[model samples]
Target: MSTSPTTLIAVPDSLDTGTPPAPAGRRWQPQATHWAALSIAGLLLSWWALTASGLIAPLFLPPPQAVLARFGELLAGSYMDATLPQHLLASLQRMLLALLAAVVVGIPLGIVIGVFPLARHLLDPVIEFYRPLPPLAYLPLIVIWFGIGEASKVLLIFLAILAPVLIATAHGVASVSPLRQQAALSLGASRWQLLRHVILPGALPEIITGVRIGLGAGWSTLVAAELIAATRGLGFMIQSAAQFLVTDVVVLGIIVIALVAFALELGLRRLQQRLTPWHGQPH
Candidate 1:
C-alpha cells in the first residue's frame, strides 16, 4: 500500500484559532461640542489673564467685566440715538431685506446662467468684475447714484450678497447630474418638471452654502453700509463708540456683532442639516 502525502490548506488566523480575533483598540476622541466649549473657555481665560495682568490698557482692550457692564447699560438705555434692541432690529432689517433680494434675483439669474451659455457669457463678466471689488470701493458711487439713503445702504449689502449667491447657485445647478436630467427628459418630464423635481433639489445644498457665505460678506460690509449717514445700527454704534474713545462700548459692539453672526451661522447650519441630511455623506 502506498502512503498518500498529507495535503494542507491554509486557514485565516481567526479560523485557525479556536476563538475569534480580538477587536482593535479605539482611541478616545472628544466630542466636537466639548472641544468647542473648551476652546471658548480657554479664550475667555486668556482674555481675563491679559487684562488682569495690566499688560494691556483698558483704553485699548476693555476688560471683560467692563464690556459686560457696557452691554447691560446698552440693553437698559440708549446709545447713538437707539437702544441695543433698536440697533439690532435695524441691522437685522437691512440684512434680511438684502438677503431676500439676493435670493430672489440671484437664484433665477444663476439658473439662467447655468442653463444657457448665452446668459453665462453675457453675465459672467459683469459678475466677476464687481465681485472682486470691495464694497467700500464703490460706496461713493452707490451713494452718488442712490443717495445716502436706505436705498444705498441696502443696495450696498445687496451687491455684497448677490455675487456669492449667484456663483454658488450656478455651480450647484451645473453640478446636477446630466444623466439624471436625460433620464427625466426620457420619462416625459417637462422643463418645469425637470427643474422642480431634479435640478432645484440637487442644487439646494449649494444654494444654502452660498447664502451662508453671502451673509458673512453682508455683515462685513455692514459697517461701510451704516457709514452712509445712518443714525442706528450695530456698525454705526461701533463707529460712534470708536470716535468717542468709548472702548467699553466699542468692545461691547464687537462682541455683539460676533455673537449675532455666530448665531445666524448656527441657525443656517441647522436649517441646512434639516433640509439636506444626505448632503456631504458618501454616496
Candidate 2:
C-alpha cells in the first residue's frame, strides 16, 4: 500500500546471474527427413513421367501401377512355375548363410590387419588383386566346383563380403586415435588390454561402415550368384520373366531386393548402436 515514484522491491533467488539459455530460435534447423522424402518422391515421379511419355517402352519399363499389380500377385501366390514366396525364401537363405560365413572369417582377419602392420602388408597385394574382381567372374568355376548347388552361390557372396569386413576391421583398428593408445600405454596397460578395451571400441564405428559396404556387395553378389544354376530365387524369377518379356516380374523382383536391403541395413545399424555405443559422431 506504500507508493513511491515507480519504486520496486525484489527478492533474490539462489540461482546465479549467468548467460541466458540459448534462444530456442536458433537459425536454420534443416528438414532432413522431409528433404529425403521429397527426393524419393521426385525420383519416383521422374520414373513415372519417363515411362508415360513414350520415352521408354512399356516392355522394358513397366508403369508403376503395373509393377504394383505384379507385386500384389506375387504376394497372393499367383505366379508361374514357382510361387514368388518360394523364390524370395531361397534368395534370403542363400544371402544369410553367405553373410554368416563372411562375418566369422572377416572379423578375425580384420583384427589381424588392424593390429599387425606386417600382416596388412603381406595381405595387401592379395586383397588388391581380388577386391576388384566381380563375384560373377568365378561363376563358371563355381559351377564346376559346386555344380549350381547352394554351396557355390553361398561361396560367391562369402568372397565378396569377407574382404570388405576384414579391411574395414583393419581400417577401424588403425583409425583409433594415437593419443588414446598412448594414454593406455602410459597407464601401464598391455597391448592386448589396450586393443580389447580401447582400440576396438574406437574403431567399431568404421567397422560398421565396412559392414554396410560389405552388405551392399553381398546383396549384389546374391543376385549375380543366383543368376547361375539356381532354380528358385528373385534373380531366377527375373530371368524367367525375361524369357516371356514380363517386365512386371522383373520390376517386382527389384522392389523386393530394395526393400530387403533397406531392412537389413536398418537392422545392422541398430545392432551396431547396441554393440558399439562409443563408436560414432558425438551426441
Candidate 3:
C-alpha cells in the first residue's frame, strides 16, 4: 500500500481527563481535634439558641451563662457540704482505687484463663454471667454484704471495671500467634520468658483497649456507687442537686463529670499511642 503522505498527529503531554488537584492553600483537611471542636461549638450554639429563644424552660435546660455562673459559685464555695474540688477528689480517689484493683486482679485472672483450660472452664461462665448485668442491679446486694460505706461504693465501681479488663486480657492473650509462641519456645525460652517477650507484647493492645472499656464502665457506675451514702463526689453533687431541682448545679455537675471523663480518655489514648505505635498499622 503506497501512502500518498502519512499524517502525524501530535498529542499534549498531559490530558485533562480528571479533576485538577486542589491548591495547597485550599486543600486543608479537618483533623480530629478540629472536628471535635466544631462539634462542641455546634452543640453549644444549639444550646444557646434553644435557651435564648425560650423554646425550653430554664428549669429543664438552664442557659450556658447560668451553668457557667454555677460553676464559678461551686469553685468559690461549697455545695452539698463540700467544695467542687473536694467532690472531684473524692470521686477520683474511688475511681483510682477501683481501677487499681481491677488491673491487679483482672489481668492475672485473664492470663490464667487464657493459658489454662481448667481456669477458663471455671471462671468464664461466672464472668459472662455477671458482665452484662447493670451495676444498679447488684448495688443493693453489695450494700447488704459490704454495708453502705466506702467499701460498697468502691466495690460497686470495681465490679463494673473488672469484667472488661478480664475479657480483653483473655482475648488478647488468646489472639497471640501460635507460630510466635512456638518460635519462642524453640529458642529454649522458659514459660515466663515466652510470656514476657512474645505474649505480653502481642497482647498489650487488647489489654489497653480493655482498660479503656473498663474505665468507661467504671464511670457509668460511679453515680450508682455514690448512691451508697456518699457524702462527697461529683455523682453525689448531681444527685443532691436533682433532689432539690437545682438545675444549674445539676448541669454543672454533669459538665464536670463529662469533662473529667474526656480528660481521662484523652490521657489513655496518648498512653496507647505511646505503648503500641504499631497497633493499627498494616503488616
Which is the leading candidate under TM-score?
A: 3
Q: Per-residue alpha-carbon lDDT of model 3 for 1-283, expressed as tens digits?
A: 2222223422232235555444334546678999989999999999999999998999999999999988888886999899899999999999999999999999999888888889999999999899999889988899899998898999999999999999999999988989999998999999999989999899999999999999999999999999999999999999999999999989988889889988998899999999999999974
lDDT for each candidate structure: 0.90, 0.82, 0.90
Q: For residues 209-229, could you state the per-residue lDDT of candidate 2 as single tens digits?
A: 888889889988877888777
Supply candidate 2's per-residue lDDT for 128: 86
lDDT of 2 at 234: 87
Displacement of residue 206 (Cα, Å) in model 3 is 0.4
Per-candidate clash tally: 0, 0, 0
User: Which ten-residue region of model 1 has the weakest summed lDDT?
Assistant: 1-10
The sequence of per-residue lDDT tens digits that candidate 1 reaches over residues 195-229 is: 99999999999999999999999999999999999
The C-alpha stretches of model 2 lying farther than 4 A from their native spots are: 1-30, 52-55, 78-80, 277-283
- How far off is residue 252 in model 3, in Å? 1.1
lDDT of 2 at 174: 86
